[model samples]
Target: MTANRFTFRRLDLQDMAQASRIHRAAFDNSLPWLKGLHTPQEDQWFYENCVFEQCEVWAAFSPDMAGIIAFKTGWIEQLYILPDFQGHGIGSALLRQAQTTFPHLQLWTFQRNIQAQQFYEKHGFIAIGKTDGSGNEEKEPDMLYEWRRAGS
Candidate 1:
């Protein structure tokens, strides 16, 4: 799909189900530990009450919800796109939105998700640290990436 066809907008509570589906589908395909670990209902609840309430969320819709990104202060908490929507510029668009919102931003990605690591790096995020996963629910190896404005 053409990038121009996608509309970006603030995500509301009503978009939780679609957002969670994209989150689950993307993670299931990219992260081995998350596969089949949570049901749609569980994801919906967590994203709606726990995540959405705490962050500023933006979504890309090709007339239909395609992907979402959530950020709080200077941290990008979550970014996900549907499998079918991958490589279509939705992820980059979401990342650009985050950059526009914050002069500097930070995020964590599973160490095993090489594609994601590359994506963030390509977008100017640098790997500033690595962790053994002690602080995350998955308890899997992860890395922290950060991006700063050109002069900041």
Candidate 2:
């Protein structure tokens, strides 16, 4: 779909439920290191507090459906699209917008998640370091990636 066909909006408290559902579904099993990151209660808490206070979440919506494209600050907190909405350029648009605020961005992905590593590399982010889980020992070895805006 073309950029013109999608509308982007800042996520509000009311949008949290949908966003949490999408987030949990998209990242849960896919990013094993973050496996239990969003239990129902945590999801609700994040939507009610953390999301609006510490991060910026943008939703991309078409006439029929909506999904979260990106969330970030100095770091990319999350980037997820509904299964049906994947590969429609919403992810790229969201990243582009986020780069405006965080000219240099960084994020972590499980070492075993090759797809996410590839996606980050394709988007100009370079593997910078590694850490042992983000507290999820079940999924150890997290790879850290960083992207510096062209000149910086």
Candidate 3:
């Protein structure tokens, strides 16, 4: 699908590197305190082995990867937009792939990311639960957000 200058497509193995770059850049940008939490190799490995192998990965490319989302039947593992792509609809377009596919969806966002919290809230996702700085590699407190389609 195409929207504006962006086109959406299933992420292929060749996209592992770009997807990892977007995830790491956005993750560190949104959580500066957790910057460099993983090396480039680790990020690439995770994207290759975990995300690509597990989820239905997709991306929005304005001739280049502007955003990416990794999602399964009921969970969104990752959603990131390149810094330059923020404020555009790339994130929302990638998110809609999941929201439109499943009747419901859930994902985690760090508690400190107010912008991310607001973005999800604006898109009809509600904070369904929370956790302390545990159970995660970053040990950052996070909230679980859920979205259910209207009448679903």
lDDT of each: 0.90, 0.75, 0.91
Model 1 per-residue lDDT at 30: 82
Residue 5, model 3: Cα distance from true site in angstroms: 1.6
Better candidate number, 1 or 3, judged by lDDT: 3
Whole-model alpha-carbon lDDT for candidate 3: 0.91
Worst 10 residues of 2 by lDDT: 64-73
Q: What C-alpha RMSD separates each model from the true structure? A: 1.1, 2.6, 1.8
lDDT of 1: 0.90
lDDT of 1 by residue, 14-80 (tens): 8888888888888898886679888899999988998889998889998888889999889999999
Candidate 2: where are CA atoms >4 Å away? 29-38, 69-72, 134-139
lDDT score of residue 66 within candidate 3? 84
Q: C-alpha displacement of 134 in model 1, angstroms? A: 2.4
- Checking candidate 2 for backbone clashes, the offending pairs are none
Model 1: runs farther than 4 Å from truth? none
Sort order, lDDT high to low: 3, 1, 2
For 35-151, candidate 3 gives per-residue lDDT tens digits of 999999999999999899999999988888888999999999999998888988888888999998999999999999999999999999999999996899889999999999999
Candidate 2 has a TM-score of 0.83
